[model samples]
Target: MIDQILEEIRRYETIIIHRHVRPDPDALGSQGGLASLIRDNFPGKRVYIVGEETEDLRFLVRMDEIADSAYAGALVIVCDTANQERVSDSRYSCGARIIKIDHHPLVDSYGEPQWVETSASSTSEMITSIYRNHPELVLTGQAARLLFAGIVGDTGRFQFSNVTEETFLSAAELMKKPFDRQKFFDTLYQRKLAVVRLNGYVLQHFTLTDEGVGFIKLPLDLIHSFHLQSSDASTLVNCFSTTEGLKAWVLFSEEEGLIRARIRSKGPEINQLAARYHGGGHPLASGATVYSWDEADGLIADLKVLCSRT
Candidate 1:
């Protein structure tokens, strides 16, 4: 499938990389690695990346250089994205031809050639597979670092249950490169003192519905009180959901005059509940936007029904 994807890549003179909205390390990493791969192998071709703004993910390098004009006659390779609606750029639909390389299941197939690997740990792992079979292709340091970071971040330093033998092999390949492992971990784990304290504040407000659904709410005012960035407020939605015994967790924070929610589940398809309020994502993790805290509370009540059903 990768070789076929590569064959398709060589057909286009211009390429644009894309990923899901509110980009994570995996999404940005795959975009970076793939762009580097193409630019290295096809020197005459033009490659660009597109998606939502994730300044933190710029650690991967060159991910910030994409221009929207690249959409013309471009083969857009979308990474780490599941649902089409959740993709960062609607302009992707306007691409001459689209190719999707993702580790998430298909919600819809917009591309002529789509690669979705449900069992893969991350999209970066798939990109590693691409480079593995063809090592003749140059592995730029920027690309290598992006792939490494995605593998580590999505695997939670290989601590998550999703870490498979394949994940280890992909990681082992990356470790062969000369990179500072300690500094990488520090970059990911280290948080501002205020950001660290805010986690404590969110944890303090946590409540579990009778059905074993855990939730934390951070009002917009509270976000203001802490002088937290919207990204910081948005980042805490999944921390509690990933706990050992919890069936589900919800993080509700206000941003730009709307309540943005991040929901996660261990044993249930909480996305159905998220869809009820005009938002969606993977079954285990999803999001919704609501007008007020009251609406968010109603969504929470609906989510409890899902938890109870599970």
Candidate 2:
């Protein structure tokens, strides 16, 4: 599979990489690492990684390498994105050929020549597997750090149930390069006081089902009253996971502009619940959005019905 992907890589002169919108470190890291690998190995080829704004990952090795103009004939390599609707940029398909390498479950939008492994812990893990067989690709220290960050973030530091032996093996392989493991762990796990307090509020006010699925809905007024920024609510569901006897949890936060929802599960699949709202993700972890708080609440009720059966 790696050889086939590398052969696909060699077929194009220009390659543009993409990932999911509202990218976390893993999404940016895979795109940046792969783009750097291509640029370093295929020195003459033009490689670009395009996506929506990345959080705390703007300082990547080749962050400034993307070109403003579309390539006349390009191979757009999409990573981490599960569904085409969630793709960060719409311009990717303007290319001549499309190759998708994702860890998300197969969705209808991904074209043929798709390489997806739903069992993989993270997209970053898949990227590492791709480069493992292609040692000729110069994986630099900075690029390695970016990849490491992604793998750790997506795996929840190898603590999530999605983690597998391959996940650790790929992470160990990545540690070969001169990456700052300590700083990477700190940046991802460390939280501020406001963030901690925000999480406290969510867990304290959360409602749980008899079957162990938990839900927390925070309105915009309450979010503002706590002075919690969107960054603080980034992983609000993480707090609920620590609640005793929790098999799954969801966080619905109302922002001024949009209604956002995040779902995390350990004992049952919840992606179908997310899919009902025009969103998709891995079975254990998924998310969706609604236009208003009322709609999001209705969706939460719908998810509760599904969880009751699980």
Candidate 3:
């Protein structure tokens, strides 16, 4: 699959990279890392990263805005995204060829050359694996740094269950290039006073089900009270993740008249549950959006049942 991806890259003079909407570190890292790899190995090719700007990741490389004409003969490589609707940009379809490189479970196969390795820790890990297989492809220091950030971010700083021996090996390979790992952590973990206070609010107000499922519902008013973006509020789901006696945790934040949920589990596969509620992701981590609080409560009830079984 990596060979086929390389062949496609060689065939196209313009390469455009994309990721999921509301980009996470893994998404940005993999997209930027791959773009850097392509640019370094094939300097003549035009490589661009296109996506919605993420305020949290503004410290990293900025996204590019390419002209529509550029996609006429471009090769689009999407990273860390499972479905077409989640893609940051629809212009990807304008490309001459498309390659889907992801770690998510297969949903809709949008590209001709699809490489979905669900076992990989992150899409960044998948990109590193490709470089490992094809050593001739130049792995620049910037690319290595971006890929390392992606791997570490998705694996929860090497604490998640998905951290395999291969994950460490790939990380070690990327570490061959000199980058300030400490500085990266400093930037990633840095939080403003507002964020810290918001976390306190979440911890103080979280509810626990009889079956040990922890959850919190943040309405738009509460979100505004904390001056938090819906995405930022959704990240607070992790605040309940490590609580003792809890089998799973979820955060439901109201956005644009709908409730968006971020779900996490210490046991049981919740992605299938998320899929039933209009969202799907990894076994332990997933997301969904619902039309009403009742629907969100239904998801929580289902999670409670799942926790009881475990």
Candidate 4:
């Protein structure tokens, strides 16, 4: 798969990289990491990473502003995205060809030579394998930093069950580069005062069901009261994850007329449940959307049932 993707890379002079919307570390990491690999090894190739920017994660990497004409004969490669609808840039289809490199379970297949490795920990790890297989490819410090950040973010600092021998091996390999690990950790975890206060509110208000199902609903008004955006609430999903008897958890943060559900589990397969509600992801982690508060309650009820059975 790496050789096939490398072949495509070699074929295209103009390459654009993309990832999922509501960009996370792995999304930007793999997108930027792969771009760096291509740029360094194939210096003449025009590589660009495009996506809507997030304030908190801008330090890791930034997006490029390319004209539509750039995609006239470009090769678009999407990383860390499971579904086509969730892809960040609509212009991905403007390219002549599309490739998918992701670690999530297949949700909607679109690209040719789709490389979806559900067991690969994170897409950044998969990107690292490219350099491992082909030593001639230059692994720059910037690429190593981006890929390391992605792996750490997706694996919860190597604490999540997703981490495996290959994950550590990839990290070890990337560590051979010269990026500052301490500075990266410090910058990646830096939070604002508003987010810190909201964390207190969540700790005080989140509910845990007797069936080991934990959930928290953050209304738009409540999030606004904290002077934060709906996306900011996503960082708090795992805040109460360590609660005793917790089998599964859901964090619902309201947006304009709809609520986004970030679901996590230790026992139940929640991606199928997420798919039923307009979302899909890994077995232990997933996301969905609800149109109303009542619908949000319905999701909680379903999660409780799932936990009870587990």
| Candidate number achieving the greatest TM-score relative to the actual structure | 4
Runs with alpha carbons beyond 4 Å of true place in candidate 1:
62-69, 241-245
Model 4: CA > 4 A from native: none
Residue-wise lDDT of candidate 2 within 187-233, one digit each (tens)? 76776677778877886799887768788887778887878765558
Candidate 1 lDDT, tens digit per residue, 40-140? Answer: 77899988877666565554554445556767787777888877887787877777988888876566777868888878889999999998888887777
Estimate, for each residue in 112-210, the C-alpha lDDT of model 3 and write its tens digit.
888999999999999999899988788988899899999988998999999999999999999998888889889987876777888999989999877
Candidate 3 positional error at 257, Å: 1.4
- Global CA lDDT computed for model 1: 0.79
Error of 4 at 292 (Å): 0.8
- In model 3, where is the ten-residue run with the lowest total lDDT? 228-237
Q: Weakest 10 consecutive residues, lDDT, candidate 2?
A: 59-68
Candidate 2, which segments miss by more than 4 Å at Cα? 59-62, 65-68, 292-294
Please give, for residues 118-208, the per-residue lDDT of candidate 4 as tens digits: 9999999999999988887789999999999999999999999999999999999999999999999999998998999999999999999
The segments of candidate 3 whose C-alpha lies over 4 angstroms from its true place after superposition are none
What's the residue-level lDDT of 305 in candidate 3?
A: 88
Q: Flag the better candidate by TM-score, 2 or 3.
A: 3
Give the candidate order by descending lDDT: 4, 3, 1, 2
